[model samples]
Target: MVVTMLRLRKAVTNLTQPQFIEGYRKAQLIDVREPKDFEAGHILGARNIPYSQFRQRFKEIRPDKPVYLYDQNGGKSARAALFLRKKGYGQLFHLQGGFRLWTGKVKSK
Candidate 1:
């Protein structure tokens, strides 16, 4: 388990707000927060897949595309990245400080 976790961690790339935003436009931006959090405010163009539902709904994200993930404070997204990595995802990224530190364009429901 430890070895697998180490490998997964090596696969995930943590990105700063600007780096995340620059790649977000071209990648599959997945907001791993819950529905209420997503509806309150989320990065523009991000899709809500709530971390709670990820095990059942992860397929909604295309494995072939670059995957960018973020949560309210980065913890959930880190776990999400590990989950995706174990499922054979190659290109994985997450916001360093999560959405709270994001200073980019956002939209709300």
Candidate 2:
């Protein structure tokens, strides 16, 4: 049997809040922000992988679908994306501007 390798591309270079919100259900959103920041606010259904624990929990993430990583400022998410790539997670993507630019409702504390 032959195996196929799946590759994921950054469809949107600068993803906006509305765009992300619209694709929320269709994508696997991962929030790489710190606990406090994530607790303060985040897009709906986004999983908190916190950069600190991301490497350790990488296996928990599903590689079959597109992964959307985001942080408070986008930088951390970028780093997380790189980490995922290094770990052979080709189907990885990150929110262009992180949660700061997301216009969706945030979870209450």
Candidate 3:
């Protein structure tokens, strides 16, 4: 389990706010926070695929594209990235400080 966790950590890249902002537009932006949090405020264009349901819905994200994951902070995104890596999805990245640190524009439902 430890070995697998290490491998997953290395497989996903952690991007700073600026870097995330720079690349997220071209990647598949995913918000792993719960639906309530996602609906309150989320990065513009991000799709809510809450970590609680990630396993069942990860396939909704295309493997052909880069995947950017984030939550209120970074923990959930990190785990989500690990799950995606194990599932053979590459081009995985996450916001270093997650959504709360994001100074970029957001959309609320």
Candidate 4:
């Protein structure tokens, strides 16, 4: 007789704008768009870690906290989420419509 434990991994969730905003103050906001897009405008407090640089800069993100991500239209963030998940990140969330559809307070460079 043998016993084995199987662990399942959770996937990132697509959070609506409201739900995303509700936890903005408490989560790590990551803008996965390009630097130019991020410079134009982005959610306040979000760090611009372009998806292009994600692999090289992933170390900038902490795996312990809740990470909320967004991109031009959700595609990039989804990809980023998958990468993060592979790297052992458990708490991950992304904006449903990405920055192009975001209607929240933003900061500009």
lDDT of 3 by residue, 1-109 (tens): 8896687669799899988888989999999999999999999999999999999999999998999999998988998998888888989998998888888898998
- Which pairs of residues collide in model 2? none
TM-score of each: 0.92, 0.78, 0.92, 0.89
Better of 1 and 2 by lDDT: 1
Candidate 4 pairs with clashing backbones? none
lDDT tens digits by residue: candidate 1, 1-109: 7885676569799999978877989999999999999999999999999999999999999999999999999988989999998898989998998999888898998
- Itemize residue pairs with steric clashes in candidate 3: none
Deviating ranges (above 4 Å) for candidate 3:
1-5
* lDDT (C-alpha, whole model) for all candidates: 0.92, 0.71, 0.91, 0.87
Query: RMSDs, each prediction?
Result: 1.9, 6.9, 1.7, 6.4
Q: Any idea what lDDT model 4 has?
A: 0.87
Model 4: per-residue Cα lDDT over 57-101, one tens digit each: 998999999999999898788889888988999899989888888
Q: Model 2: which ten-residue window has the lowest total lDDT?
A: 1-10
Cα displacement (angstroms), candidate 2, residue 106, comes to: 1.9
